[model samples]
Target: MANIIAVVWDFDKTLVDGYMQDPIFEEYNVESKEFWKEVNSLPDKYMKEQGVLVNPDTVYLNQFIRYAKNGTFKGLTNKKLFEFGKKLKFYKGIPDIFEKTKKLIEEDSKYKEYDIKVEHYIVSTGMTQVIKGSSVMPYVEHVWGCELIEGEDKDGAPCISEIGYTIDNTSKTRALFEINKGVHSGDSREGVNANTKIPEEFRRVHFINMVYVADGPSDIPAFSVLNKNGGATFAIYPKGDLRALSQVEQMRVEGRINMYAEADYSEGTMAYMWICNKITEFADRIRKEERDKIAKYAGSQGPKHLVD
Candidate 1:
């Protein structure tokens, strides 16, 4: 048992509401819904016009999937993309969740025995800088999300040259590989750390503790991955978001999530309370098992061996 070494989070709709709602898209005279509809409608012709050289099915399918799932766009220069990122906002009580989760990680006795260290990470397909500039940045360990190609303008602020669209389950796994354990993309397996191997870890421990909270279909892949890996995932449906609720139900039906609950951040809110309870239960189980192990080991030792 170990104090939670890391806690990963999904940005955009999870920690914040309406980031992908895209007011700027609306401001730019493109309704996101209309844009998605148009993109889906023009698959073959659009791919041909863009001169996309990749697998046509992959490109076209991902065009719609990315837009619907993660709100990605094509042909946008990184500068304009980052500019759009700068304007996003968060949901109510988000700041408090960080402050409180941090405090609990530090002060809770059950977690303390695990030498639990808490690291907040955002796995998002949204803009990195958008998350970086938010109030939550100071609390998180690292952000793995869409990055802009780094180029400076006349004012010396980094401009977005291209959106990497670098957050999702697969990318999240890659981030865990590269950042946490220095595994590079396409690197030989020989170079990787054994501890970071997810499959091996799952096999060794009947219960590997993790908690993931996410908002919508975009999070399904991530939730599914975490849940399948012997971790718990909570699907959150924010108030006023019927779409999120619908997605939650679908995820439940697919057996893709561990739990589904409303997205609320008040100390007494269902989401907050449920997460706290789950963390507490995991911490308690690990702590009790660790104590029993220690006691058993102590009892197995020869008494006063030095006296002999």
Candidate 2:
């Protein structure tokens, strides 16, 4: 039995109150609203002008690179992105919830016996460096997100010249399988893509042992993946934001998520309660499975004689 329980997260509005890049826009004195407007138009603009198709989820990175190259976001490097992470404002009960939920598994003696524990992973479309620098980085087991490669500008100043990696909404499911198979984690394991024949029960983290949390429409692909695979799913909406609330409610109505809550993860909040309960539930099931397996596979006591 895979004794590890995984909690996967999507980082943008799911955790923070706003986009992580807002700090960058602030630092550059650019109108973030207008920048996003252009970003939203890039896919169709490219198709009409350059006969090209682009990923709507990540084409914004290209715009970022363009601005960096043009001196608008002068000397923008991964290091700067890391520094920007400190400026992020997370939702209520953030890293606190992360720590508290993880401790639930530790509270049970059976969980300790089976080495069952919870691990937190962030799979995002945002910059990885920023997340690595966030307050919650210490609690996070791993992060999968967009990346940038640093190179010199014409003046030899450091800048982000190229995109290194990207995890779009759809590709986010690949990160799910990676966590399922223990890729890029402490365990030395193959990519989920490398071995197509691995049985579900044999994966490093089974789907039943996972819980995924995120906020909006961009999370549909990931939510679908977990929902169909027996994993738990949750959605978050900002408080008093009826549009955000309605979005998640519709998703719940459509059976895309097991639950939805406001974006507060602090103690006594809905987000905290639901996530912690799910972790406890998974741990309970895993404890049962491990104990049952030991009895079933321990080789039948060599034909026991009735002594009683």
Candidate 3:
């Protein structure tokens, strides 16, 4: 039987467009462009005062999630996040990309020989409800991302709180650790159940075996963890965005990711083909190694018919 290949992805910028900008803002009646303009101005108005360089978008979004958690804004409740989720748009070719990927995996003889089951998962700091509401929800096994604690307002109306949503590395890390416990221990070769806790002593499989797709600094820790440990991280950017592409290259140089690609799904596109080929190649290599190990052990046993 062939080994399983698990493809873990980050939501938003990676799998789909980063909606932190448009629809999300529009849904809440916030001026999208102005919000980003103010976000960009923060470094000069705030961070620079403290002798720090800040990416306003990151700071702004982080703060917004915090404020939303505190109920300072009306209609920005956790449920609203899901309602807003329905309006998100994709860059281009996302739906086709997934369909093509599935076809490629199912048709590849090598994948079939190895019993390779391409299990796709979403690991994000974005809200799970938003992911569930997205079009891709049907294809993925589950989404592991920031979650809200559902409760009620003083008037007994439904309310949402980011009290437990992961917005920072520490929280994100914990969420990742808990969601995919076997990653930390490495011993989950057999498989993992969603609700089961990970056992100690097994480190998660290397990212080389995983094609991690993500965007932004919040994804850095997860990206870095995969890259440093031999897994591959692909930093996705909007098509023709030179600046974001530059950032992806910087991350590559910094050893946070392995490659950069436009979020396109055309045949032979780097993202699709590379991942497809690499998965087959990985399976072949593992097979050869295991065979070699078995051969070595057999040799040590000498002639089976010979009496000891």
| TM, every model | 0.72, 0.94, 0.72
lDDT string for model 2 (18-84, tens) is: 9999999999999999999999999999999999989999999999988888788899999999999
Candidate 1 residue spans exceeding 4 A from truth:
20-44, 48-87, 151-158, 163-165, 176-207, 303-308
Q: Which stretches of candidate 2 lie over 4 Å from their true place?
A: 190-196, 297-299, 304-308
lDDT per prediction? 0.60, 0.89, 0.62
lDDT: worst 10-residue window of model 2: 188-197
Could you give candidate 1's per-residue lDDT for residues 1-308 as a string of tens digits? Answer: 34353456787667777654364565445577776565556656756799544432123334433332232333334445445555566666777887687777678766676665455567776666666766787787667776555444334444333334555445565554333442321222445652555454322222246677777666666666667667777777778778878888888888887777776777988777877777667667777777888999888957665663
Give the C-alpha miss distance for residue 275 in model 1, angstroms: 1.2
What is candidate 3's lDDT per residue for 167-229, written digit by digit as tens? 444344443443345532333445554355544323343334666677766678777666665
Against the true structure, whose lDDT is highest? 2
Q: Specify the highest-TM-score model's number.
A: 2
For model 2 the local lDDT of residue 135 reads 93
Task: Provide the global lDDT of candidate 1 against the true structure.
Answer: 0.60
- Residue 134, candidate 2: Cα error in Å is 0.6
Return the TM-score for candidate 1, rounded to 2 decimals: 0.72
